[model samples]
Target: MFQFHVAPSGDDSWPGSAERPFATLDRARAAAREAGGDAVVHLKGGVHTLARPLELTGADSGITFQAYGYGTPEQEEPVISGGRVITGWQERDGVWVAEVGELDSRQLYVDGRRAERAALPGLPGEVRVTATGYVTGGGEPLGWRSPADVEFVFRGVYPWTEARCGVAGVSGDGDETVITMAQPAFGWAGELYNSTWEGQSSSGPGLPTRIENDAAFLAEPGTFVLDRSRPGRHVLMYLPRPGEHPSRTRVVAPVLERLVSVAGARDVSFRGLVFAEATWLRPSAAEGFLHYHGTGYYEGGGVETAVIGEGASVTYPAASVTIPACVTFDATENVAIEGCRFTRLGASGLGVTGGAGLAVRRCAFDTLSGAGVEVSGSRATSIEDNRVHHVGLEFSGAPGISVSGTRDCVVAHNEVAHVPHCGIVVGSGQGARILRNLVADTMEVLADGGGVYLSGPQGDSPDNQALVQGNVIKDTHTPYNFGLYTDYGASWVTVEGNVVLRADNTAVLVVGPPLENVVYRGNFWDQDPLGHDNPPSGVTYGGNVTYKDERELNAATAGIQSEAGPRR
Candidate 1:
């Protein structure tokens, strides 16, 4: 079953059916390498422009690039696109040439004879250079000669008029003047304004332009690397809207940073796409969405995603997903990311650390700028049936699912909501199985927090065996909140038949030390008359049902028993 059709008016043979088709995707990948092995090249939707970056070499059982309808089929389905309109410019000898415009600009020759130039008074054409006083001969008049022993380069003016201007110099001594700008001029019509070194430096009119020196300018567009030290400067003339076309929202962040380094290439796939309104800067910890390093098996099917801004939607621009405090995993196993939709990412949306066995099913991680699913050092993982909602907005340390140092993990039947903190957190794990999950409006505030938060560390022995059973925690705002929180090195834990309701505070909270074996059976605590927080030992409340106000249970003793339900 092989059918190819890629417009621009088809015809490059190899049974080029669909009424004689085959425009380009490298002549349908050279007729799928002369029909020698794995196949399926059907991309017939819209836009396709790739002059470079298309490497899907030989195959040995690794290929599947699909996108042909099923769920999320709006914005004009069947679309595979690529763009390039960086036009003409040349000044080979002496660095300052232009011809890459989707929002282009060029002009560089900041040489004030052995550089050291200063003029700081509301920057009227700006100048601040010093990095061992620049000296690169030949009729020098490019300003900057010692304002603290110099090395400076600041040549500006490319807010796109289809950019084309010239001048170049960098004859050694802390050299730097590499400006290859056109990722739509810092994307979405560049307007990340506000820098005089950020905050309370009044000089407003359209405030958003800064350039400090030690000579180092590198804003590599396509391969992605938005910021690299030595006072790197950028503020390409703001244009939110006014006949907008800053290279089609800055070319959707260099085409999602070149589709995350070819998304683990090997029979690669990027189908029917439209990466709109972009801006993904500095995402590395081996980045996400699709990252598999060799040993064949890199497949990405039917991706129709959108990342507004904040480092192109994931991997901590502000924090939606950031895993890379140093990653190490060799024998990378069959990685898979199905049906994608990771919107408004930031502050831990889906971060799995140092992968071993990762799986994020039926993906739909919510409007985040932080926390909705963060698993650390993954090993034998399975975050099943996901439908995680609008998590903590960068405040109460957001949690809707946070597991640490993973091993044999299983956070089953998920459906968590507007979390502020702790909706299901098993920190520093071992044998974890937080079964049948359905936690609601979990722990917002009241100092430390819980809706099923089990902690570890403080004499070890905690990560042995954990099981917070049959979950269904209800509306909790916080008042020393607890629906099931066990601290102090939890060992062999179990909180059965869960259904804790509208608790203002405390339903079952056992803190630090004394847990050799803990169990609270047949649960149904609908307390809110302010109760709970002190049961460090002997916790085995059977056939549970403490309706409310039994004189606030008068600080239960005598093996605590009150059984009686049906009063709100």
Candidate 2:
């Protein structure tokens, strides 16, 4: 086995070893592949900027990229990033501006903290559509002079879509304004003229969006606006935090979409690295979720004032909407990513498809716009002991770990919290097990969510079931949220031995489909019992350890263990 050392100061021309370190991970990976036979590339502590992704193929098998002499992931360990740090800045018009190279960039980070896009919620008042495609609304018109440059991005009548239309101009009387949307709706969420949901109607719809690249929203420190919307001027305007000068504060914009693309690579492990600020592709479909009725997202005779509609029959962010992954794997096996920090990513952290014996464990994912990990069509894959929180920040319907079309997979010992939608969603396939993960504080944004959700979208298909057991699901306070939810068509699921501590609506929620498909046993719930929305067969609930009071329940389930036995 060969050992390669990579540092920021070393050169690719030199032999990659401890004494002569390589300058970049690309150089080290190339050396390791040539060396072959379980070569190790030890990365020294520093930030490595990646203008492009590090693509690893089958030839790079058995190569391990680990930190130099580090037991656990240190704060200052090797960070492989997809952002370009820009330093030269000159303040102009109360907004610090810096000329940038990348024009289509959307995500920006200042001193390792994400910058906020300038966005205003809700129009000042209800809008009126005129003969010309102009929308006149009586609300706070976003103050903008450059009509050709500043666009009106928004969540239209269908709250499940995030789109923008170029502004013809901003015209109105004071706060009340007539904002003209571009003909086809150009930016992120764009659809047909007057397009509504599947079963909803709308007249004058659309809320003001958090418009990036606008200088109006730069209010305080740690907030930045990348102004690429203007012609010939790709400027990044930022408000630095207190005591953080522009020269000192690192301002970065995500340039690369993927950090590592491990396709057809086997027996390779990426450990103890920080992957941050990776970009995601703009949506091709509708992606946004908002229930106009209330924050609870319940629709009990709730009128549809959001879009020009009577009532809403379809949910926003339909299951078909999907974003790209940051670290993608396909047709590869025996790969692992351990002790990594996946934070401030613009998209999903990791995705594995068509592989086996792959593992993503002991990783921390935070401030992600999409899901923590997306696993599909893989068997014997393990996702364990990871901490995923503050995910699904921008995306509407992303779960913590989305497992679909995979069998004999294990998702255990992870902590998923503060998510927008479900915690762990097992969409299809059998022999899949979701166990021992502590899922809490989920559904903070959208509605009708669950900690552990199971469903098979293919109707009347084979009995698709997953072993749901030993998880402690708690604090799902969103509307229609539950500890465990088996949606319609999610059949043959065997739920067992889970401890659910809920004070909201129900502990176990079942919705739709073949009633005889779900089985529950030996579960513990101190909260209310099952909440079945509409089941033709009803749930089969038995052998459950239930408690009335919180104190008694806590005492009874104190020493309870997962099906895998006590956590080591």
Q: Name the best candidate (by TM-score).
A: 2
Model 1 lDDT per residue over 1-568, tens place: 3445455557666455656667676776666656652555655555454544344433411433334343345422332322232223332332223333232111111110011112221222322322212233322223422112111111111110011111122332233322222222122112221123222321111211322221122222111112211232321212122332333333221222121112222333333333211112232111111111000011222222223233332111111223221011222333444444443332344455544555556555554434566677567777766666665432234577777767767787677776655677777667777776767777653234577777662122445567777676667674556666665456566677666666565454444444546666666565621213344454555565565644443333112222111011
Task: Give candidate 2's error at residue 371 in angstroms.
Answer: 1.2
**RMSD, each candidate, Å?**
20.9, 5.7
Tell me the tens digit of each residue's lDDT in model 2 across 97-180: 788755556577777777766554434456655533345555444465344445444542443233334455567665557766
Sequence-dependent TM-score of model 1 = 0.25
TM-score of each: 0.25, 0.84
Q: In candidate 2, where is summed lDDT lowest over 10 consecutive residues?
A: 291-300
